[model samples]
Target: MPNTESLNVAVVGTGYVGLGTAVMLAYLGHHVTGIDIDERKIEMLRRGELPIYEPGLADLLHASESRLTWTSDYAAAIPEADVIIVCVGTPPLPNGHPNLRYIAEAARSVAQNLNGKFQVIVNKSTVPVGTGDWVTRILEDNAPDYHANRYAVVSNPEFLREGTALHDSLYPDRIVLGSASQEGIERLRQLYRRLLEQDFTPPEGVPRPAGLARPQFVTTSLNSAEMIKYAANAFLALKISFANEIAGLCERVDADIEEVVHGIGHDQRIGHRFLVAGAGWGGSCFAKDTAALISTGAEYDYDMPILQAAVDVNRHQRQLVVSKLQRHLHRLQGKRVAVLGLAFKPNTDDLRDAPAHDCITRLMELGAQVVVHDPVAMEQARREWSHLSYQEASSAYDAVRGADAVILMTEWQEYHDLDWEQAVASMRRRLVIDTRNVLRQLPSDTVLEQIGRRRVQETHALPMLPVGASSVHV
Candidate 1:
């Protein structure tokens, strides 16, 4: 068995998952080498600069700098690693299945550098269920001289949110390890013993959660571990979609959704975590994982109607922003529509499958001049959305000034503390579509539209669409 006191850990990939894992492991007293093919990212990490925006990550990274190393060469790191963690991105393909090209490449590279030392290969990426077996096969095929006893493959999926990744890593709800080999599981258990036992000093700004003395260390078959990740994300997405669906019905029935959710949330079984109604659930995890789960079921000839409907409802939620705009402006043609928020959520600059992207695209298609702003994602938005025709505002107020209508897509604290009275005074048409229902202390006369909440102006008639705009839908 390898020494658990201070193991040599090689974490592949420097994306959100990989970087967070490396930093956390380093803080836990492991000598971690973070390997990635991206030279620029590795160079940045070497200079103590973060490539991504995650709360408390940079501080934790700095604190763990002594035990951390960054490099682009896998051969330099993998051979000496007692634990090799594959945290590469498995982005979803057009057909809703995750493209495992990165996983395969990482596996092949790890296999080729075995160095006759027994190592445990851990899959921390969210991938398809059978990937553990596939990775094991690849390792066996690549390392001809080494026997099967030389290495073991394990599935250790991560459950992390972007903004709170450090906190999640330091004090996760549980630590799950799945492998056929008991030895592989035991190695990981020892590696995570400090976290599992809550024995380490809590990092500054990321204190241990209340009543969380120790987190469960769950172990299961490899397939079950992989499915656990997908199922957990899909269920969370479903909860958000369910809340949105009920929010729609609440509006139709003239009942307030906030009161309804609050009333039901009081029940012990249904706590009020993901029950808030909003523009929709948008992030890297929910949509991709839910789609992948549905695709997995289809491969086995199993139908997943609930998961499909969740996706359909989320897509329709984005379109509701445009529909609300049309209701106020009567037409989108030549209108100055300000989209307040570019990132999928508050706190991070991730725009993968963001609702704002869909809304802006539909608005542009309908001839509206879209001006967008996010607290931190503007640079990233410019990089990713340069081809799209839209103006980037320097601030939220800049985006809203003289705009015909404002759509609050993200609930940033800055947006919440916005000068609503002044914002309404500057707007040519004093209408604000609060998609997140988070805008507070609004001017009573200013037109405020919200999802699942009664509108400021109750109009039952549908507004007329602009010419050629009827074809545009999110």
Candidate 2:
């Protein structure tokens, strides 16, 4: 178990990272105060209503209400806290660089509120490399008598995936704390000792996963810690793009991309995670992070061709889906197109960088009359994409009814179990472009199109395999 020295922690911003950190800390028996500029959201949180949807968040919030407090007033949250975590959003600007204004403001607010007490100001935000140095400079310039070790700036970037933020926080793969100050690092480590060691007994229903390790603890320089986040996200993005690139070749050779990925993924080095070929990646992180990394490289007079290629392939995947639709229907003008799924990926309402949005834009440009349906993303589409004059369908059945063709954009679990019999009965035409390659084996009557698989098979002679490699007795 961790030290019972309860630290009062202030979490700046109430977004996914902030709220998850606040709730997790509070659940760990620490007094936590979550600060956000949005008063309405603060009020909503106080009323036990979450502004966003995350699995298992509400339960944690309700369980830790006694220890957690939400406030817009920074002074109320910052003064008493021994640890201040900056979790503000750093959205990408037009030039593909992350805008650091929010981080700057959060750091400034934290500095101004330092009331003669030592505090470990942790950068929980995913900022550019060297942001720790920037924070230190801001503190020294603003706070009185702020010398070395008076306050420590630790870069503790979050690695939580949306929709599973709560679970990811409690059961992180590793805990990385980067700072120049050894004293501050030890202090923060003690703060997270219990979680780091995985010593806490599971809270009733929250049984620990089998063989889940005590998360590896890495204490590194602040600069390397910032780069780790960018490098990890960029590498994962590359894996998806590389898979999609191979899928295109598979289409040319009449070989199945699924078989190709299966053969390659068996190698221990290349596991089967994110080896999916589809409309490409669309989430809050990948695009912006990749772009920012490329931009950062440019600042150092380096051009990242590999990252650039990955991004290009992702963009082309969306267009490839459109091209397939064109081949089937030929003329898209006045054709009724039913779009299935809207939010970037399943399990969240975040529509930023969603491939479905690009598909909708292109379909509209081709003069296709579009009708859309998503189990959860319709309201998001309506609010953010109100300019698009597309009809709304309550269910998949309603969306496909009288439609010439259907495009499966997001692979929601609900979509996988869709009633194909009813869907076939409702569609005016039989063409279904499943970008996710998820519609396993469609009914014989329906014409299926997948991103990585060829719709038309080319007759080919099979080469003789090694004796044991072949199951056929020829």
Candidate 3:
């Protein structure tokens, strides 16, 4: 087990990634200090308010308030930390490469603030393969003195999903660390000893480790570790887009994607995850990381044709959803549309490259009045898309009230059990677009058409169209 009695961890960048790591480490009995540039954000943290939406995160923060400290003081955080984890965002550039300015800046600060003993600087952010070497060089360049052995750099990329980030962090499927030096590897092993040891079970009744010898600690080289994150995300992104592409094929052949996904997911070769056929993958990780991987391929004079196609398909999938909406209604013009969810996927309030953004923007461009309802994404959506005219509704039915059509964009749990009768009654026209393929059952065809209602099933749908498609009644 980790000697958690007196370990100080400084987490730079207090966004979702940073906050998640800091709070989790604190929960694991480490003295964690979160450093960010935003004073207002720091104040919010001080008040126990988390800016982002991640289930079990706020409660984790509250539970570990005594062990976790929030601050904007870079100097103080760095000097006091024995292990500095860089959990900052590495946003994609216009040319589809990761912008490493934040990573470099954080590394420089950590290097400049070096004080007592040797520290392990863990790169918990998804970065390019050579980033470990780059961070090492950057830190060495900015060191207080030329003490080469003062600090060690290790790449320990995070693999937390936005919605269940807390759970993923605390009980990760695998913890990968890449380091050149023995000391750096040992330090990370010590920091993650609890998880490595697998002392705690995965919550109550949450399925124990399957066919595994407890939880083995996997350590690898820095390049492999960095490559692992990109490769993993890229493959998952490919799977999502691949499933979506298959979903389109299924729709064309009148095959139910749900049944197909269920069948395919049962195959041991294709484990069930990221296979939901809907508006393609989104949020901070998949897009940026895939693009970064492609960029890396470009730099090496190699091509990632399959990954490139996956990215293309994901982008095109958003447009496909918009066309499906337009088809459900004859035209989006003069239509009052309700978008039920905004976040990329459910259980989180992250709207980065969300399909809802594309769907809403396209609908508005075609002259539709859009009202949106999400259990937790309203505030973030308001901030991110202030210019879009949308009435925030308390419930899904409220959002669908007086709407020509309602589009289920993100598949939130509340949208799962929608009151079909109320929804049909509230809508001026009963045209529904089920993009996520989440509709379980509907009223009989006669009852639905009698109510002038039609449900647009997202199956074998064509790509990039100008509306006008066949719809199923009920």
For all candidates, the clash counts are: 0, 0, 3
Ranking of all candidate structures by their TM-score, best first = 1, 2, 3
The candidate that wins on lDDT is: 1
What value does the lDDT take at residue 251 in candidate 3? 62
Candidate 2, which segments miss by more than 4 Å at Cα?
A: 1-3, 203-206, 454-474
Best candidate (score: TM-score): 1
Q: What lDDT does the true structure give each of the candidates?
A: 0.88, 0.85, 0.79
What does candidate 1's lDDT look like per residue over 135-215, in tens digits? Answer: 999998897476888898999999999888988898888999999989898889879988888888888789888788578
- Model 1, poorest ten-residue lDDT window? 465-474
Q: After best superposition, candidate 2 residue 110: deviation in angstroms?
A: 1.0
Model 3, 205-314: lDDT tens per residue?
23345654534566898999999999999999999998888877776675667777788899999978887777788888888989998888899899999999999989
Task: Tell me the lDDT of candidate 3.
Answer: 0.79
Model 2: how far residue 17 lies from native, Å: 1.7
| Per-residue lDDT of candidate 2, residues 431-458 (tens digit) | 7899998887555556778977866421
